[model samples]
Target: MKYLTIFSLLAFITLFSSSCDNDFNINDDWADITVVYGLLDPAADTNWIRVQRAYLGEAAASASYGEPDSVYYDTTAISVYLEAYSRGADGSLGTPVNTIFLKPDFTSRKLDDGIYSTDDFRLYRTTETIEEDKTYKLVVEKSNAKHPEASSITEIVGIQQSSNSGFRFVLPNPNVIAARTFNGNLKWYQSDQAEIYEVDVYFYYKEVNRQTGAVEHLVQKLDYTTIEGAQIPADPFETIDVDGSPNNIYTLLASNLPELKPNTLRFFKSFTVIIWAGGEDLAKYIDLNRPTEGVNNSKPEFPDIENGTGLFSSRTSIMLDEVAMSQQMATTYYLSSTLCEKGFAIVTSGDTCYCERIPGIGPERVCD
Candidate 1:
């Protein structure tokens, strides 16, 4: 009887051990989620390069999807994130400075069935002025209840100066209106459409008062378009005499007059011909794998004064996105590079000087 008791006790201990080993909870229908990521850079071939794949799964639900007699998966959720940054010295992916949150507008961002879709295409914009020369990286991540992993960023984007003024001269005449300095003739030829947009030369310049010694600044920029409304047509360009719809160039000569010092004050020191490219033109380099519109979309690539690749060089083929590219109607240099290279000279038919500073005769200044 004692021997029988010992055997029974040993069996009981074995049963307890087996029960304890079954501590793991069975999960049902747990599987890795699918996601796709890509990159777009204007400098490169202008196409979105697919980075890699990632999966998210729970530890308890380690088994593949479609398990028989398995416990139901309580978690039904997923998420994705794409990060962008400049490479640090170590090269192990520096701090993520710029990132793109690629979730549809007002929609649930859940990557199910492992079929994720997104064109990680994006054009970089510096909240703080992006220096003329700098490089940045773009990273993407996707996660879910079942699969939580990441992918490497094999792509890098660089910000390059679009143009070189060589010698960006401003109207030297002190009496010249601030705006007149920007007035210039604009001519362009494109296959999709041939039309003139704003003929204005955009630039960033610091202004310091000659009398008060107070420093000031004047900067204006916008992506341009010749698709009507965005700019004054060539017909109007002739009317401005400066030759562009934004007749503002001529107005610059007449706009608010600033104190004058021929040699002291400076205009357009770091001057770059800001080719105001509108979204229509910039669409050339956009990674269309994803959808973009209005302000949310990447701004179009505008023509500027950069050498070899300035607006004239890239006039035919514009940067659409990483996944797309286009060509200009004619590679032939159309815009007068000569005019862009040299500063504006307001020519009043008879006056020998490039421009004349007509003293303000507005009603506001008619006092004795």
Candidate 2:
């Protein structure tokens, strides 16, 4: 069986540029495909929709995309809007609670070897929160005669709460940096309707100004090296266990902190863990993107948008905030030998660090 190509199939719910327009066109193609991509998260403060047209023609001989107009759309030719609706008692659609007009925003990114270019894109965004239990519809209209208007619907999924749903740090002595190494378990209950889960931890710290005694509580979001691409099981009682080790947490912090100025000493604050649960649409999209094991290597069909391409899905997130650090973590990890070698000023304390004793005082510096 030949693989059915869906534009933006590999980009998840976001438009990460699917390569439908290669320079060389080996096959004859005359159809202009309308591609749309968006993922709705109720926890987010804003949402964005990306629209693009698939180009089919003889590929250019040169590597360069000669002109900007070849890829992007004329802003005046496109119109986008998002309509929100709440469900009724009988499971029917109610009147739209709000209608948001999306504005056109052009963005660009730098590629490898200093190559700068803009994508064939017209993005529409709104600063409205997509609350749980409400359904959303995205409508895209175009002035072009050939491309038909498109629409997609997504029902926002609520989060599943767990009684003991948080990361439990296993620092035997919170005061020692060496012992402060992570030896704990991050746990969360599975959502019955969610197929995917993402676990993220943000490390909080403080950066103080030496001259004026000003302070800033900086946060470092830790990327999961081992906890990525995790899925929630069908059994809701099965808790997801993210094995946390000292190396897992500290290695990430050490690599990211040096950029903040290795020479400057910063005190470690608390950490927060964020858990995200994805809706059914997200699960279908994930399964469709996976490589087939057969000789055909064909992709599965998983488009949710009606009269267009790509997914419109919902996700909910919960954050465990203001988590405190143990004493061992403060003395060792905060001002450890590794950090000291990198020019972080040595902090002198009288039994307890000044920040801990006074609460939110930040890091203590030399001569203060």
Best by TM-score: 2
Regions of candidate 2 where Cα sits further than 4 Å from its true position: 1-25, 59-69, 85-100, 106-122, 144-146, 159-184, 188-193, 205-219, 225-243, 254-267, 283-298, 306-308, 327-368
Counted clashes in each candidate structure: 44, 11
TM-score of 2: 0.60
Which residue segments of model 1 deviate by more than 4 Å? 1-39, 44-182, 188-201, 222-246, 250-271, 275-368
Candidate closest to the true structure, highest lDDT? 2
lDDT tens per residue, model 1, 1-368: 99999999999999999999986755546343223333333333323222222233464344523441232111113233345555567755557765544332212232244322322222212222222122323322333423444333323212232222111122311233333222233333222121222323334445555458777666544333233333433442122122343333324422333444442343343223322222232233232333776777665543321111111111222221111001220111111222221222221244312222234631111111
Give each prediction's root-mean-square deviation over alpha carbons.
21.9, 13.5
lDDT of 2: 0.61
Q: Cα deviation of 196 in candidate 2 (Å)?
A: 2.0
The per-residue C-alpha lDDT of model 1 at residue 353 equals 23
Q: RMSD (Cα, Å) of candidate 1?
A: 21.9
Each model's lDDT: 0.32, 0.61
Looking at model 2, how many pairs of residues clash? 11
